[model samples]
Target: MESLEHLTPTDREILNKSWAIVSKDMQQVAVNIFQMIFEQAPDAKLMFSFMMKDYNVTDQDTKTRIVT
Candidate 1:
């Protein structure tokens, strides 16, 4: 799954369906992942300066925009 080139047709379909089901929560999931990454390496947040300023990064709305 880490390599898109290696994904089988069935694997892709499963992933597609799973994404459809989880898409609504994608923003929160992205935000949580980003938070975890930033917590592990505080400086990593600085790399995404553009992402923060254009959207309300502290909330899911920005995350949704970024993800979509």
Candidate 2:
């Protein structure tokens, strides 16, 4: 695994700032990210049994289940 010790203070600051912006709409981001993952790797969806049954990426319940 990569160590955080390698990250410079400036890098950490930039990451924090970027995360702050993305965290504003984290629900949507998680949905979009998972959707993309499924699209890019159709087989990946198979790992999640819940997705096999009437899966809908935009559904709030599905998004909640995905991120949590």
In the range 1-68, model 2's lDDT, one tens digit per residue, is: 37878999999899999999999999999999999998898768858888767554445755534221
Off by over 4 Å in 2: 54-68
Task: Report the Cα lDDT for residue 15, model 1.
Answer: 92
Residue-level lDDT of model 1, residues 1-68, one tens digit each, is 36987999998999999998879798998998999997898657557876566444344655533321
Checking candidate 2 for backbone clashes, the offending pairs are none
lDDT at residue 31 of model 2 (Cα atoms): 97
**What TM-score, over all chains together, does every model reach?**
0.51, 0.71
- Model 1 earns a TM-score of 0.51
Candidate 2 versus the native: TM-score?
A: 0.71
Clashes of each: 0, 0
lDDT of candidates 1 onward, in order: 0.73, 0.79
lDDT of 1 at 60: 68
Query: Distance from true position, residue 25, model 2, in Å?
Result: 0.9
> With candidate 1 superimposed using the best TM-score fit, by how many Å does residue 9's alpha carbon deviate from the native?
1.9
Q: Which has the greatest lDDT? A: 2
Poorest 10 consecutive residues by lDDT, candidate 1: 59-68
